[model samples]
Target: MLRDIDPILSPDLLHALRAMGHGDEIVIADANFPAEGLGPRCIRADGSSASDMLRAALSVLPLDTFVPDPAHSMAVVDDPDAIPEAVADFQRIIDDTADHPARIAPLERFAFYERAASAFAVIQTGERRLYGNIILKKGVIAP
Candidate 1:
């Protein structure tokens, strides 16, 4: 238990967040995500919802302001325009927690998987909702 830190953020997760540099990306993935096979390191957030994990991560990780879209979510198959309930929750959480105003850009299913595979790390959450996955780019803290 650290002071002011969300309990949901385990030690390993905190280490990953702290170790990431500006522009490095991390994925907060749903239960269905194949995090283990992804090239990057995987952290398990079992029993935690995607929204809960997102909120906890955003509490300390700053979103990259250099990029137009610092956050991303998987798009519903064949319906790029449709926002699933979990994706909507992700937007709300980002809106509430990010240092700057930002929205989660929708990524094609394969595109999203490719991005996740290249991320600095993947936090696999136990969220059962389809398409609850999200990716966040790390940003530098202003001096």
Candidate 2:
């Protein structure tokens, strides 16, 4: 167990985060997310909640400042404006953890799936909440 690192972040997850370059994206998906079917490297964090996984990831991964929205979450079907509890938690985590003030924008259902499929990796969490999935773009660490 590495000091200062969240225990929930397994070795595989840490490797993926470290390997990602600026602009590369990673998905922290809910239990319902078809992580395996969507492709990309899938890392299972089945015992962790989406929020827990998000917080752990953000602790080390910097959000892309070049893009307006470095973080994104799946929108509720037919009610894109609605913020689910899990998504609210995500926003809170981002607000608290990000080096910059990053807000999580909502992505259309299919659009989110497409983005997740193209992500550098997907961390599938055991969060049971609907629409708990989030995508984070990696950013450069300033010298």
Candidate 3:
């Protein structure tokens, strides 16, 4: 038990977050996401929702402020304008955690998949919410 560390964050998750460099991305994905084949390394939180896992990650990981879009979520299929309820909750979670209203950019399914595959690692959560997948770029903690 480390001081102030969320128990939800396992050694693997903490290691991945610490090992990631500025601008390196990580994905917190839903159960439906193909995370096994998506990331070079994967951390599984089979019973947790993507938002829950993401909140836990944000508690420890800093979001890259250097980039215009440090956060991304999968867009509703066949409708770019369609925002899923899960995404709404995701935005709320991010807003509450990050305390910023930076818009969550919507990505096409294929683009999201490609991005996730290239991320440092993907955490697969058990979230049953549709379009719960989200990606975050790591940032520097200014001294």
Candidate 4:
């Protein structure tokens, strides 16, 4: 086991994260998310909460500062303003980990799926919360 690495990060997830370059995006999806159908490389993190996986990912993954919003969550269907409990947890996780806490941009259901399709990879979690899916854009480590 690697010291300081979040144990929740499986070898596949770590490889995907390492393979991704700056500006590339990764999706952390809920159980309900149609991850396989979306077409990006998929990693199964079943039996784990999206929040847990998200935190683990944030531990190693740097957020894209070049973009105004590096974090994004799917908007509640028919109620874009309503934030899911999971999304709130995501916001807190991002705020705690990022050097500059970026707001979680809300995307409509279809739009979110469209974006996920182009992500470098999708980490599907067992989280049952509605709107638990979030996308994170990778950033470079400063020299």
Candidates in order: C-alpha RMSD to true structure: 0.6, 0.6, 1.3, 0.8
**How do the predictions measure up, each by TM-score?**
0.98, 0.98, 0.94, 0.97
Q: Report clash pairs, candidate 3.
A: none
What RMSD value applies to candidate 2?
0.6
Error of 2 at 93 (Å): 0.6
Candidate order by TM-score, decreasing, is: 2, 1, 4, 3
Winner of 2 and 3 under TM-score? 2
Error of 4 at 124 (Å): 0.6
Cα deviation at 102, candidate 2, in Å, is 1.1
Cα lDDT tens digits for candidate 1, 35-109:
999889999999899999999999999999999999999999999999999999999888888888598899999
Q: Tally clashing residue pairs in candidate 3.
A: 0
Q: State residue 125's C-alpha deviation in candidate 4, in Å.
A: 0.6
lDDT (tens digit, per residue) of candidate 3 on 1-143? 89988878989899999999999999998889988875479899897878778888988888888888989999888899998988888788888887334678999999999989899999989999889899998888888
Q: What are the lDDT scores of the predictions, listed in order?
A: 0.94, 0.95, 0.87, 0.93
Model 2 misses residue 124 by how many Å?
Answer: 0.5
Per candidate, the number of residue pairs that clash is: 0, 0, 0, 0
